[model samples]
Target chain A: MDDLTSDVMFEAFGKTLEEVFEASAEGMFSVICDIDKIKPEESLTIEVSAEDEKTLLYEFLSTLLTESEIKGLFLSRFRMKTERKNNQLIMRGNAFGEKMSPEKGGTVVKGVTYYGFKLEKTENGYRAQVAMDI
Target chain B: MKGKLKKLSEYKWLISKELMKDMRADAIIYANKKLLDEVEEAAVQQLTNVACLPGILEPVLGMPDMHWGYGLPMGAVGAFDKENGVISSGCTGYDINCGVHMLKTDLMEDEVKPKIRELVNCLFANVPCGVGAHSKLRLNSRQLDKVLVTGAGWAVENGFGVKEDLNRLEENGCLKGADPAKISSQAMERGAPQLGTLGAGNHFLEVQIVDQIFDTGAAKVFGITEPGQITVMVHCGSRGLGHQVATDYLKIHESAAKKFGIKLPDPQLVCAPATSKEGMDYLAAMKAAANYAFCNRQIIAHWIRESFSQVFGKKWEEMGMDTIYDVAHNICKLEEHTVRGKKQQVYVHRKGSTRAFPPGHPEVPPLYRDIGQPVLIAGSMGTASYILVGTEKAMSDTFGSSCHGAGRSMSRRASLKKFRGEKIKQELEKAGKALRSTHPKILAEEAPDAYKDIDMVIQSVHGAGISKKVARVIPLGVAKG
Candidate 1:
């Protein structure tokens, strides 16, 4: 993907994730499959509501990663939707995780942690809170 | 949200009952006005929450480096009556016994100045670092068990270090009552290959120079002096082992929290009564992890000695590569202290705080009794690390505990996005410091900018009379994960 296209895709991922949760995204993502080589063949929908954006993002990504690991799926596509009312966040998203082929091993994200978590409003757009497992 | 901070003195602030609900006792935070303003809201709120724990002593104390963390704020010290208190895994953090070890070397900066890059290269090559970093020496299940049970003693017995080194370590390099059997298989597997590795995020091995000495007597006792005398500080923990142990117990303790009818203000502070089976099991496993960390640093220290010997063409003994001290910043210990004018045994939880046992305390090593336990507080790379001693005031006020370091000021993401690692490296190098790392991103995450000012942190504790500063060591070379 070109730099412009990649930037657009990232922006779309951020906006869609925020729309479903009603809060800014404040976590990280891992490409479960080789982004350049894999095709999106299956997807799983996950939704969770949490008291705050921090916990909501943590639970949302953690659920996806846990489910993906157990079912042998490799997440290749990501999008989110959010709604916030009275300081509560309702987050919903579809993370596409294709079944790993025999020739291709899947990438695994251990789990999301509470470090470096943030959710804030911006002038032009929103950014997801990001944290690394390692 | 600003707390109800009543100024007890120029350096002390008290959070009274008016600040929050369910407080069992007042919360005392030591900081000057400037330092207090830099503290995050979450940190103060967490201190209040910690104050609400059952059986807490009269005051939940926050040290100078206090910052936001899982259950208790980092640099918090709380003691509870042994018969009625609770133990929370969050109080110990995921990295059980994460700490700093300082080694004094005869080689001065002037001697190693031309070879600083080569020295760092040697250290980086010898010390495994970064995410999932594994050491060359992988331990079998039985050997790993020995590590958990014996700690640095295991390292000494196996010839990783000399017997003298144990004398300077807290608890003589091993916390008794560690039961390897209590540790889970997952924890064992994670720890097996990570015995001597330096895991990522704030972990480093730095070569420093004793740039200043504030207390002449204390500096002489610590054998640190002058602006050019060289030292090495290793910062790490039990690696995957500690993380897995904490993870395993969190699940167990969460259930225990309900069974014991303990209502924690934060789910992360899941805990059980100190006498409960779950609590005992967690403590056993936690101590085992703590031992693993002690042994991990011992082995790494051995490797550092070897690296110096190889590069300098002299034996470590000849190079004066002697250990000054080893201290654990995350731990809970059962100790007897005066509470309410009577001696009582209490479980003291020091998260991101160091135990600063005063002189004559039997727990202090014999060699340090004349002086006091050497408290190692590591600052960020390019900053100043300090050598301190436990004070009588600390035993009375904080259950013998003090701040660990200049607590983090900004999140890693914020730090990385704001600064470039290459630029940071260049700046340090220009300032006569050497930088070596396997991953540049790791360097960015732990930039000095991410932490509070070390000078202010030291001042607060020194002013509070908890831990007295001995010497200040500044960095000459740094090796990061």
Candidate 2:
């Protein structure tokens, strides 16, 4: 995870696609919540399909941001996996968090931005960068 | 070819189409030499990218406060043809209709100074602040739809404000053609509970005193009779609902761009042809979210009225608390403007800009139409916000627009590293401005040092004859989310 102009950017790497996706989700939540305080008492599942890996990554993080507002929860831990089926990228994911409490630190991120958004394979693994609008 | 900008005037510069390939129009910027030089190449590149977009009616324009943004620069304007141009969700921003409004009060600084701390505390308690701060009223789905349609009118009808407030708001506080059905359930759910919340990051409610009045006649029209008069400034927008609208539509626009065969220089510029089904749908939904923002601010304004009434132990109406004006900086609108001596309707995308209609323009509310639209340029927490009036020059030059705020000279991360929030708070307090916020880091990110000298930005526009300075308001108390 890193930073872009006026937005929070994340870079996640792993040997498998699911590992990078999960890392990306965790990195996003870590920016908005203290993961240590989250008890993982509530579980949420999200499913989405996009044209490619980059769009898939954007939608995945966007869903999490929307869920935070809709469910009134500050999510922390996340588990996800992506698969390519019939030339489309499909993602099924689960997120964990609890109700938003004032004791929680960190600011709210408005949305994910396409500014400097990219997904690529590293020398050792797959990597993705997502910049969130804070 | 990439960074060359030909000086056009003292405060204007042009990047010819020769600077970038596929550019349909020249890129123009309203900036002084220092500001022009300070603009990064990447942000300028975004302007050139905007120039290359299809169906642009005039030169791509950037205000003095211009900086890098997702697709278009933050302080950029791109007015496109209604039939042939495109509509972009990215251009409108994440928090739709994120804007600032000012309310005037008869009380002066001397009257409020002794009770400044109490007043600040009352405002903080009355108005919801911080992330996930829920509104006192949890509206159902049906009421949410009414907000998406009636805008501030809904708030007034619900006893939040008076009918006269609708007259002072841009678009009468509601945008026509806003189809609530176009809004997704996700956007609805997020909006329902979040109404009236002062969301985090740069959103604030400030108690100010009329520090200086530049144009006495203009200031008088804006309800500023004398210096030291108390005023309240509310800065916020359509919290989660507007964000979700932009987020949901961005994906649709991305696919629509491909479907329309529009090759964008940046993915963030993804857009649909303005007349296409996708474009129409996005516009409808965007308007709905924009209305939500209007109501959101209206509700806050009502609460602010209550807080003032409580602190003074008098009715707000008896205290002469009246809405001066409300304007949205983020969002696009269909407006009639004269371009190259021809009258036409164009969709003006003002990302980090405000509508500054010249005097006598029909769109200008009747009350101030003879004077011009009141342009509110909010400064950083530590500086003075200027009230400017629109000029005819702006109508022909920049689609009747002006800079929105003290545009950030540095990014949030950079500011965080350069200044501590606690130190900034202390500095503000020492300077007689009481600062309160949910998180200290927010104070650091919004430090005045992180932004450009707002006076210089105002000078550029005023000197360029785009807008005229009316008055300056200085902060006495600030509450942030």
Candidate 3:
């Protein structure tokens, strides 16, 4: 594992959440919707600062899934602002979503889970991984 | 980033601020190295997330039976300042007052073993089990409100339990400030016909015998004379009523969290300030569900007594089938505790945890105040359960809480996939234990191996002085859902 800056890790997380949600929707709907149609609003920034990376990812995704369900929006863009502060990963991210329509996508992401969640800093970049709870 | 964990003692591990950001205090877990190693990292992450919650006092603690769960871990305990902290439904889980109630009988194992088959048969016939199982006693909307407000008292007044039973129950069997109006129509409908039924997944009623005495003085206080004395332990909760309350509030809390600017690590931990409308509604509804659960268990206990009376041609009173104590395992209560050396009213959430108030606490009933609150820990069938007492350490350390049971070692699906119900039943029968159940799949999910060793889990807590063991119970027969 190589040393990667927290900012880089945070960026990767934001991108990953956006990509995962879109890909999951595409997989569920069996059609790829135009991501460009969904616009990113001023980030309703939320942060999950925890000791370990695994739970950080679990909590982050779980929060996003919950927020999406409550707000009835489908996330289309994500941008992470992460920093290593005092030995903990402090993650700040903007998760963007468009109004989910049955005609556009067949289903919504139900939840996020802790199963198979991983966060590791490799020689090239930081990777925060998770298995979406459908 | 991983930081070195400092061993506070043999059973305590400290995760310092050097390991997490915005942590007001250290995160301490009470478990041996072996147990600690087995804990999911997700739980530890949740602990650190809890540290970020406003006005947290001291270390966020996890008991030995710790495992991953929504928001807070199953065996987690934390306290916060009343003025600043938030209240979370996830901290209490979907099942409100999902707890344990132990009944003592005059009959010994020698007396009941000969009639074990008949006894279990009667219990199986009387107690409803399995998912969506409804009872013969259905409640109208108006009567359901009474059940919510009065709790076990309603059951007793309706001849479900005796008056003496109230004295042994926490909150005297009825929680204050329970507004039935706060409960949703869906919740009421769900609970209307399920009053006396044992809902599925880890809920059970077991016929057990006192197998060992750890503290003779406490054992005597709790009325366990010696080994082989038969007892009954009932483990269930508010059924659909509580689940509906939780679901109703989870949405409210999510919106409340955004409005209040409360950021949580997990959506399950979504919450509102203690004084917010969302928080108040949740408390009211939660109390109502708690009452419903109390009444639910009271009814089941009554039928158990009735079943015994039918078989023995004697009244329950003549059989000495008295409730020793009933304690809620999952709940949040507004309690006054010393914070910064001043008494402050804070909501304490116990998820997969039991209230273990020390002796002489005003909240404890008068009769058992000197002996401390009886903490009942029910184990998987064919394993040892325990009766314990609250200690001063528990009051000071873990928000007057103790472990609920041998917490799940695996998921229900994993357990069912690994173990067969028929084989498990045969194994128990070979060991001279009788089993009766409505759902065979439930038996597989609740197989003994699905849970941690209750003996070891109880020993760790007892050894730590958080709670002291009184009596150990071995199952004679079990009724599972």
| TM-scores of the candidates in the order shown | 0.84, 0.97, 0.79
Candidate 3 lDDT over residue span B1-481, tens digit each: 2136688888778888667667777778877777777677777887777777766677777888877666778788767667677788767767788888889988889888988878888988798775434487968888999999999999999988889999889998899899988887767776787789876567888999899988888787777788989899999998867876876677688889999998776766778888888888898989999999998898999999998888778998998898999999889888987755677886888887888899999988888889888989988777889999998888877778888888877765466579988898899989888998764555776788877778878877887788989999999999876
What is the lDDT of every predicted structure here?
Answer: 0.77, 0.86, 0.75
The residue ranges of model 3 lying beyond 4 angstroms of the native Cα positions read: A1-134, B1-3
lDDT of 2 at B70: 73
lDDT of 3: 0.75
The two-chain DockQ for each candidate, comma-separated, is 0.07, 0.57, 0.03
Interface RMSD of 2: 1.8
lDDT of 2 at B431: 77
Worst 10 residues of 2 chain B by lDDT: B1-10
How well does candidate 2 score on lDDT at residue B222?
A: 72
Give candidate 1's error at residue B450 in angstroms: 2.0
Over 4 Å off in model 2, which ranges? Answer: A1-3, A81-89, A102-105, B1-3
Cα lDDT tens digits for candidate 1, B1-481:
3556889998899999666768888988988888898777778888888778888887898888888776777789878889899888867767789899889987888898888888888988898765434578868899999989999999999999999999989988899999999987767876787788876567789999888888887777667666688999999887767877876787688889999899887776778899999989999999999999999999999999998887888999998888999999989889999987899999998988999989888988887887778889999877999989999998898899899998887765566678888888999999888898764655676788888899899999989898898888899889876
The fraction of correct interface contacts reproduced by each prediction comes to 0.00, 0.46, 0.00
Strongest candidate by DockQ:
2
lDDT for A116 (candidate 3): 41
Q: Which TM-score value belongs to model 1?
A: 0.84
